[model samples]
Target: MPHDWKEIQAGDEEVFKKVFDSYYQPLCLYANKILNDIDLAQDLVSECFINFWEKRTSIEIRTSFKNYLLLSVRNISLMHLRKSGEKLGNSQFVIQELEYVEDYVNELEEEKQIVRVHQAINKLPEQRRKILQLAVYNNLSYKEIATFLGISVNTVKTQMGRAYRFLKEELKDDQLTLFLLFGSNFE
Candidate 1:
């Protein structure tokens, strides 16, 4: 659905919702990647959406709306960190993670794709899920994960291979998005 976001500034509520439904999860994930606290990330991203809606008539976005919303969330999350004086973790890691995801924003358009990936991952077997989590969530290499979990590298490799096949076969259209999101970990 191509949208005239410029027209959204004229108080088009329907398009506003379509935009909201489209970007909310990805923006939350982006903010969470930065803040590392899902609670704060959700709060900051929700506030961003609220403010976006309230000030919709005046918001001027020359870039894609995705960039604007992401920038807004990033700024607000950073501001929260600075104001609270909360040393959330390695700021370097947060910045690096943000940059990594931003590199793929152009390829990620449908929010449903993210939801589908999550659902598919949840449907995997218990050990397979653990392997995928250790790989993707912790960003651990197969050898590192095997050593840490006291398992053989072949077991780790096999589990990851099965997880990738499941996600690829189940999410046919979003294969690229899943690959782009989790490819580095599996490889």
Candidate 2:
């Protein structure tokens, strides 16, 4: 154990600091992999550590300290994603993400997949891209997007369909977008 759970539970600041120093960077990196946002990732990891310390006395750890901390960071990051999604719109992305994202994290840890996913999304046509963004990012409905873009609901749906098809083709080699593109009943 990198940390003395009993000593830390006894309220030793030095031991807590040591554990913090040992795991902070790696935990942040793990969170970044989960969130794709470095700033949010860092913030979440810091809070996870703080919570660990605050709950030390009552928390039971049957696993290694490192595993416990990693699990904590993962759960905290995913919870943040879910909550932020709810606040923003609670749309399809969040629902699909909750279902598929953990699979991606476990299967692919390389940074290249993130880059590839971004690039493929960027390659979409302007109108199609905008529709996709409004639907997924802004969490707008087909009717809402049609009104916002001054188009018919059918047109909005068509454009969004094309956008998803393009993204599916462009990202055929990567499953990272499975969360982003699927669950729309597009397939």
Candidate 3:
């Protein structure tokens, strides 16, 4: 509905109104995915737009205007989450909107866990890493990996055991380490 944001910059109330009308509902829905309360989502999105209007003359959006508005909503939602003191990593507190699962999965904490797991796996001896990747990521059986790698099944078994032990030691404190690491949805 918004024809041009530059019109708003030129002091066009009609343009601003059209933009607000077009974006408000969808932005509220997006915020609700993070906050899980439609009323609160509406309030936050309204507040964000109010602030946007107040600063309309001065705000310098580095990205597209739409992205700036969405980022504002996202930051405000995360601030609400932190203010509520939710245990963010707890499965119960994670985002429940199936469509927004990728948003949660790409969270900074989860990303860091993924990076740490990758680093640990990379540090593994090459053969063990390859075997572990075959067994876990590629879903190959020990016999299959042995045949493919031209190694004995017993060797595959031993290497897999060693790899598991190493990973367990590395990820001992991260309860969802494996789930985060091997989850196909995350990839």
Identify the leading candidate in terms of lDDT: 1
Worst 10 residues of 1 by lDDT: 1-10
Candidate 1 error regions (>4 Å): 88-92, 110-187
Global lDDT scores for all candidate models: 0.80, 0.74, 0.77
**Model 3, range 1-187, lDDT digits (tens) per residue?**
1236678877788888878886787778778877879999999999998898888889888876776877788778888988999644434443344235334433634667788899889989999999999988899998999999999999998998888778778877664676556554222
TM-scores of the models, in the order given: 0.52, 0.45, 0.46
- Going through the candidates in order, what is the number of backbone clashes in each? 0, 0, 0
Quote the lDDT for 184 in model 1: 58
Off by over 4 Å in 3: 1-3, 89-187
Candidate 1 similarity to native, TM-score:
0.52
Better of 2 and 3 by TM-score: 3
lDDT, candidate 2, 19-115, per-residue tens: 7886687677767767888999899999998888889899998876766877788778878878888343334554454335444443444455566
What digit string (tens of lDDT, one per residue) describes model 1 on residues 23-111?
77777888888777898888998999889989987887876677787789988988898889987678787777667666656556555
Question: What TM-score should be assigned to candidate 2?
Answer: 0.45
lDDT assessment of candidate 2: 0.74
